[model samples]
Target: MVYENGKAWEKIVKWFGYKLHLIVDATYELPIMYSLTKASESDIKEGHRMLERMEEKQAEILKRAETMVANRGYDDTKLIIKCWDKYRIKPVNDIRNLWRDGEKTRLLTNYKNVAYNYKGNVYCYCPETGT
Candidate 1:
């Protein structure tokens, strides 16, 4: 689990009606990993701190794996993120209606510059037309 600003707090309020956060580290497959849970305290209030915690866990796991595979000179590891959503949450009707109207414009404007450059390159490379 990862916490983003007040998102976790909001989730706690919405779900369990609490306002706390927790950071948990555990060993899985002989390596350490971490997760976040919201409660009544603020364990991670900033994104950067949460990122640091993640990096710390990753480094610990890497060091442990390296030590275990010292003789082989190589090791393989995989990290996974698992999320559990209990409530069937949906956007409000008004928001959904407004989103349907504005989504295309938002998406188009967001990608317009990138798409223009790509299309320019495509047309520049036309073999028959010799653009």
Candidate 2:
């Protein structure tokens, strides 16, 4: 697995372990599915793979899911697009903050007050967008 899976994230952490990823039904609060992978894995890829598994193993529940929420770690454009395109499930993954010279900053500085909302409706809030 090391040759195909492990990746050197940095110098100190010689990671050769696995990570557990899971998804749950928001309403029922029951676990839906889980996956284990090498620690050097990408969360976005794992997320999609988990959904694909759900499509095969739990098609009924997967079909009914309207929205999916995840942290910034799972933030990927392709994942977001695929969630809607393949399953009609909206992805509400938190976006990482943009940076300026290694300093964290909002993506759109002009709209300082414009907040990004992922609670249910996945979109940014602005007067023009009718938020």
Candidate 3:
């Protein structure tokens, strides 16, 4: 797998933030997976590159496994391979505190305060829109 990150490890340490790129193959009962750290690179920049690298690596692994399986020829066993991608981001802020009642949910607390929330509210001014 390929890991992509800018030179922002210091910021990540200070703010308790992390970014990850993960791939999983779950077709079989015993899943196979790979993951890598991506500190602060944009998804658009790293997405395609990471996927391509993972595909190549997974193909090699599968070929090796296939050869082994053919040699052994295990009985009544199935080999199903799957590949998928995942990404995660954590901003350095307590979102629960930003809420009205400040009641933290189980998902929020479990994720180390790193989950997106969409309560019943709307914002007229969106920073991304610059409106």
Candidate 4:
């Protein structure tokens, strides 16, 4: 039994097994890479491992990749930076709301009337109305 903590909703899940992590091409619906890890492993960790392995075993695929889309489970800053800085691939992972004190939607810059939410959705507020 694993007690998942530090989440908005916590629960004790009765699970004991391995998990299959797959890097799939969304357009073609094909599998690019795969690995099996213990259930306790984190999605971010597995994502990093898969990218590292791809660099060594399948550099061509990584070079041709444009974006890495993933679920909220893999919403990690280090992993996102790794994909962009090393491989130049834009990460489109769903983000978790990690803001404190119930904050939401921060201004992108003081000069611009643009703001973005935790999920990376940009909003352009009207300067006159400030909506």
- The candidate maximizing lDDT is 4
Clashing pairs in 4: none
Q: Of the candidates numbered 1 and 4, which has the greater TM-score value?
A: 4
User: Which scores better on TM-score, 3 or 4?
Assistant: 4
Flag the better candidate by lDDT, 2 or 4. 4
- Candidate with best TM-score: 4
> In angstroms, how far off is 65's CA in candidate 1?
13
Compose the digit string of candidate 1's lDDT tens values, residues 13-105. Answer: 344544322223323443343335555434323223433565565645333331111111111111111011211111111111223343332
- Candidate scoring better on TM-score of 1 and 3: 3
lDDT of 2 by residue, 11-113 (tens): 4656799988979887888888988899998888898888888999999998999999999988888888988998899988778754435632233556644
The clash count for each model shown is 5, 0, 0, 0
lDDT of 3: 0.36
Cα-based RMSD of candidate 3: 18.5
The true-versus-predicted C-alpha distance at residue 129 of model 2, in Å, is 28
Error of 2 at 76 (Å): 0.8
lDDT of 2 at 26: 78
- Tell me the deviation in Å of residue 72 in model 4: 1.0
* Candidate 3 Cα outliers beyond 4 Å, as residue runs: 1-16, 29-33, 60-131
How close is every model to the real structure, measured as TM-score?
Answer: 0.21, 0.65, 0.27, 0.66
lDDT of 4 at 35: 95
